[model samples]
Target: MADTLTSILKKLLNQPTAPFHEYHVRAQIEQYLLDVPNVELSTDAFGNLLATYRKGKHKSTPVWALGAHMDHPAWVKVPGKTDEWEFLGGVPKNLVEKKENIALRKESGDMAPWGFPVVFEDGKVHAAACDDVVGCAIIVAVFKELSRLGLDATVHAAFTRAEEVGFLGAWHLGKHWPFGKDAVFLSLETSRPVNGAEMGDGPIVRVGDRLSVFDHELINVLMRTAAEQGIRVQRCLLDAGACEATALQACGIRSVGLSVPLGNYHNLDDDQNIVSEHVHIEDVKQMINLIVALVATKHDGLGERTLEERVNLRMKEYKKYLEIGNAKYEEMTA
Candidate 1:
């Protein structure tokens, strides 16, 4: 499994410009999924890959979408230079050094990075494409584990494209997908340490993001489940960014985000940090356990609240956290 993850990471790094041109990565991941028996697969026009594992007892169970973006920021072609390049926002420099070939590309294209170095390495680069690839690996790992345990949940393993550009694929999936609004949506993305989701510690449960806040009841349930299962979890809020869950929450879907803390995000090269290396595998194991429990557990009196209502409630929650944070700061200073 580690070897497979390493190979996938190498492939993703090799194709740095994988936003809309992720056909190669898609093919590779599809092949990996095909190796799992009894799994069904499908793709959408937008290039979102969906893998389904059906349960015999819950044949009609509503689908729960677990997603991650398959795109990363890369230098796009500009007007003049054929071999010039710049760095994409949040890409780390250490990862860039791993590339064997360095070339400069033009600076006029849609994905062009402003004033940063555009790099082209000759050999495979494993670290650069891990921003979302790690998330992808997590989803794949979860699928494998579920299959091994013979669990039942109509789980949709989604790999979306063009998230770096503007969350385009997620917007489409959340708005028009055939799944019901009540279906739980979990976005596997990268998180930072400031929000308490640190690399090497455990997976993060995002309570709120820049785009939309997660469903409160679901968040509470996740927290409780994590506690009951002895899973290491961190509560976090993306102060300035969002993920695929944003679109789902907007569409009245009960959503949350699970992220592995990353270091050196959005910089040129991968020199920022090594926090992800510390993300304990045990944390991932516990996260998968919680997911399985959620799918298998049944409830009759779950409240029916609109997304707008959830958002309102989340805002209050955010304010409370902010106040607590402020008090802590004051205490430290005093």
Candidate 2:
């Protein structure tokens, strides 16, 4: 499993990608999934890639729809100009202006854009596009592992584009609504660590982002699964930036988020150098492990509890205390 994780990460992270220019990343993902059994791939009208994996019987009523973007911050060539260019996506402005050395694509390619080279050493990964490419890689690994184990489950994954520029791909998909409304969406991200989320601790069960709160039931399910499987995971609100989950949730879909804590987010370090983004290798592995377990056990058969149900349970527990308090108040009043 670790080998597979490493292989996918290398392939995806090495691809040249930018907002609205995710051709190479999309192509790599296609090549990787070509022979995976029981999986079907398709693209939405807006050019987002979707993969569906269905096998055996499903234990949960709502199917799982996982999503990740395929773009990173890069300088895009301005149309009708040879030398002029404009930056897309979120990176520190000071670092962008510095114009550090970027790793160009191996062969002659479209627009000839470049980014930071992927370097994996000392149990850490530093890459140009770990922001969401790692997220994309995680989805690929999950699909492959689930097929190999032949788990009875249904999972859909979306490799969306242009996330770095305000969730463009995600917003479009939400408008079209490809997956059923009943399906729950999970946004996988390599996010800036905030609110005590730390790299190497484990993957984070994101409670919410800056934009919106996620489905409580889904968060509970993810946390429960991690505890049950003994996988270390953090729970927090990664408000460093908004993710694709916020867009889906805005469209009225039940959405939640998961992340691997990132360092030097968007290729900008504390000193403002334009270097590769960083993530702990073990955190990536644990993210994969937790997602696989969630699918394999069909969310550990913990049926989604309604708000009323949760409140009722608590209410029942405190009812005797409420009665006792009422009697004491009545005696006082009399």
Which candidate leads the pack in lDDT? 2
lDDT of 1 at 169: 81
Give the per-residue lDDT of model 2 (tens digit) for 1-334: 3337888999889888888889989999998887888899999999999998888667454577999999887877777777666678776555566534333322224343345577889999888779889999999999889888888778888999989889999998888878776688999999998999888899999999988889988898888889888999999999889999999989888899999999888877787666678899999889988888887675533655657888999999999999999999999999
Best by TM-score: 2
Model 2 stretches with alpha carbons more than 4 Å out: 1-3, 59-61, 99-108, 111-115, 300-334
Q: Model 1: per-residue lDDT, tens digit, 177-281?
A: 745554678888865556546656667788888867887766766666677667778888875577889887786667888776655555332444322122334
Cα lDDT computed for each candidate against the true fold: 0.63, 0.84
Any idea what lDDT model 1 has?
0.63
> C-alpha displacement of 311 in model 2, angstroms?
6.3
